[model samples]
Target: MKPLFVTGSSPALRLTVALLLSLTLIFVDSRYRHLDFVRSTLSVAFYPIHYLAALPPRLARAVDGRLASEADLRERNSLLERENLELKSLMQTHQALQAENRRLRDLLGSSFKLRDRVMVAELLEVDLDPYRQQVLVDKGASSGIFVGQPVLDANAVMGQVIRTSPLTATVLLITDAAHSLPVQVNRNGLRTVASGSGLINRLTLLHLAKNADVRVGDLLVTSGLGGVFPPGYPVARITEVRDDPGSHFASVIAQPTARLDRSHEVLLVWTLPALSRAGELDERPLDAAPPAGMDTSR
Candidate 1:
């Protein structure tokens, strides 16, 4: 059945009616009734869409954070490695200083009994040839260093200065085959010549008798006869004593007291007595013997 058409009601009037119905529903919800269930259901239905919409940005942020953390870890590891290496280097330097201090203390203690005026010198180079055991020092002719000047370490005799340049000097170590020095047993004051055996640790006591007063563990010190090394300076300690009747000379070996391989500093000593103005009575020459009297040789 067709309803009666009102003359004033047009399309706009019908649209207004629809809007009023929606507004009534909104007023009813705000006034007394709760729409929480509807809102939660709508949110739950749209959750997958929302998560998908935000997924790209979240993944990008996660990747960026992980990369930053890895970079930070790498930087920290590198820093720690560098610090560890530096600490090791510092420890090594400390140990070296400690050793140097010990050597200096020993040298100062020995200086009290020495008659030679000693000067300090640094090692410029070390040369341990298969045929020669020698070292180079920093002092030379300009520093009043001459040939035959004795060089010593903190413990014992190191060498003699054999050659001198303007700024450098060559030292022939006591271990060289050609080097020899007059030494005496500290126990019995038996004087003898200790010759180098070309070995850094051993010196041969040349021409010892079968019944020598020397024995193992006897300390050998300078006899102060050569006008080079001062008396009372330690040279070596007797380590072996062999009496071989077949051989004319007694076989004896002594170990040097000096740390020839480890030392970096040496003493340049002047042991020769100052000559008189007239040069009448200087010390005995290297090959000459003292006078047959009370033996007033320095």
Candidate 2:
């Protein structure tokens, strides 16, 4: 009557009843832990397939430690921008060697308060011609310079040597509109001339007369009556006087106590013993005379 699907057990009584029900469920799960709630409910039902089989190696070790900390912060920001441009080019070369050692100690204190025979030189080139206030010098005619010589600078009369070349020499400055010079008024010796308004600092005086006692902080100097600069030295300071009663003369103006565009070094003088014979001081004539022991008394 129950032949509908009862083929049931037979292979040796169903393998001895599945080995006696797997040794009676391994002897009741090894003693009496009733299969600990069926092995903790099948390990909480296969805990999300063991955390999705360990995420992809923990996100590949967190993107390889964030690309090795951005390649060690771009190699320490390019070594602090190359040590800040080599400390601002060694602080502008120690402020240009302390302004060339205070212009060589004011040209060795004006060659120890001069009495002629100087030397120094240096300024090799500068005539940008704002009306030709020239410069050049590094000594020429083999250091005996020449062409009307003169040239000073630690403060005063900057210009004379009109051209030479055994090495270099040009000078001319004193403001240069074809220059002048022969000053005076150290406060009263009055005589005048100055000139050169091509202006590197200015000059002009010429024929003063309008009752010319020429003031405005006077000073002028040099008037060894133009033996090419050398009577007392300075040259220019009066800074404007004017006087125009129908212009009989007296406009004044001064200013150039030399540094004409800031001299870099100069002084050549040797005044005149024919400038130590620099070839008979280029055929003499530049008013000529002053130099032996010099001191043309104010």
Q: Each model's number of backbone clashes? A: 0, 0
| Model 1: colliding residue pairs | none
Query: TM-score of the candidate numbered 2?
Result: 0.25
C-alpha TM-score for every candidate: 0.55, 0.25
What C-alpha lDDT do the candidate models reach, one value each? Answer: 0.73, 0.68
Cα error, residue 209 of model 1, in Å, equals 0.6
| Cα lDDT, model 1, residue 89 | 97
- In terms of lDDT, model 2 sits at 0.68
